[model samples]
Target: MEKFKSFLKRKDIEISAKRYLIDALGAMAQGLFCSLLIGTIINTFGTQFKIPFLTSPVAVIGGTEYTAGGIASAMSGPAMSIAIGYALKCPPLVLFSLTAAGFAANALGGAGGPLAVLFIAVISAELGKAVSKETRIDILVTPLVTVMAGILLSWLIAPPLGKAAMSVGSLIMWATELQPLLMGILVAVLTGMALTLPISSAAICAALGLTGLAGGAAVAGCCAQMVGFAVMSFKENKWGGLVSQGIGTSMLQMGNIIK
Candidate 1:
């Protein structure tokens, strides 16, 4: 028992914040940039903005014209998992294992898919990592354990978490509608902060099915963070900085801003 206790107290199991940032958040960012940001930009500018020939749907698949956003949305699940696995420092074999986990978690989570993938992927990675070097056939062992853990956890936990996330979003949306001035302020501040944080406000909004006042408020908040920072830092960064920070991502300077 004492030996087990000592083993439990070892630092190897302890996941530090820096590690989390490097592994988890970093992965999320990559996924978001590739799937969400790039996709959104392509969809929005191409479909909505009038830029002569450029403003047309990028491609046609399955009798449907697909904009950048549409393609990105479809690929979000796998992209998120792949980037996340890379960040988690997963071996090549285990990296693909996380991809399987990501699909299950995202699918089961419904609207709040990314968040579900986030939780499941991180846990599964750790579990897989623990047994990674234990077996001679690491290729077989790591992926089997990781994918199984991820799928099981997704089945057991994702539905409830997704529902909870949706519920919270609904409450906020309703509140925003009922009391635009008050709830708007609250949602704007909170969701805006969420946009800048490591999480995905778009996924949350979609999960919550937020629209009308709440959706508007969410957009406002995100714009405030993105454009606000870009404009504010214009003096220091110049036009290039404005384009990068504003159009590219306000979170670019998150660490520096925090400091």
Candidate 2:
């Protein structure tokens, strides 16, 4: 339909980049909650927690043991997708439809799950957007079509793409490990720059499964940016500057830094 075409036109590559990549993936996906939930809390606190539920691992037949963190990690994909859908201005039906798509893409993509969620969620959102409010029986028609289409796409496309991304990420990670000294500094600097550049370094790290020495370097780089900015702006901004840069994001001062 003409209406569908118009809706699709509205969601050009540029718009998708802004809505999915910057707003949803960067700000919300890798923001405070995710950082705490999946990053620090799950990785640090959860590991240290002595609670039975938190520490006890449940074994699956022919599969790795499931822990609290693993469960939380599984949920991250859908959560990130919903955030993307909401940012893309999807209707309730469409947004929920993306949950299914996100789960499939993330699961299929494996270690590179978030990237898959981003890509599939965008496709699913746009498809849903095309049909949003197009009919009076939107409640029925909209959801039915969106969910079906999204699931179908997930089945057809998500798995192989996810494997490919994971494969590429594995190669990069292996390379980083093989040359830790040089790669560490490079990754740290680049990921640090990415953190301040209105992009999701956390997402990138997660997508690539960047761990070990390289991950440590990446953390150092992020800390350098935050600390460097916080210290530089101490005279004028004071505590606000500290909280914003040190505890918040160095990106807050991007304009002043650029100026």
Best by lDDT: 1
List, residue by residue over 17-66, the lDDT tens digit for candidate 1: 65555556555656766776777777668657765444556789988876
User: What's the C-alpha lDDT at position 225 in model 2?
Assistant: 89
Per-residue lDDT of candidate 2, residues 1-259 (tens digit): 8875665677432354445556655433442234324533554565676667666675453577766665565566677678777777787888887777777766676545555666777777877777778789988887777677767777777766656644444444654855668887777777666666533355567877667787788789889988998899899889977866776567555445434
Q: Can you list the residue pairs that collide in candidate 2?
A: none
At residue 76, candidate 2 shows an lDDT of 65
Worst 10 residues of 1 by lDDT: 5-14
Candidate lDDT (C-alpha), each: 0.72, 0.65
Q: List, in order, the clash count of every candidate structure.
A: 0, 0
Residue ranges of candidate 2 with Cα displaced over 4 Å = 1-17, 27-36, 57-69, 167-180, 187-259
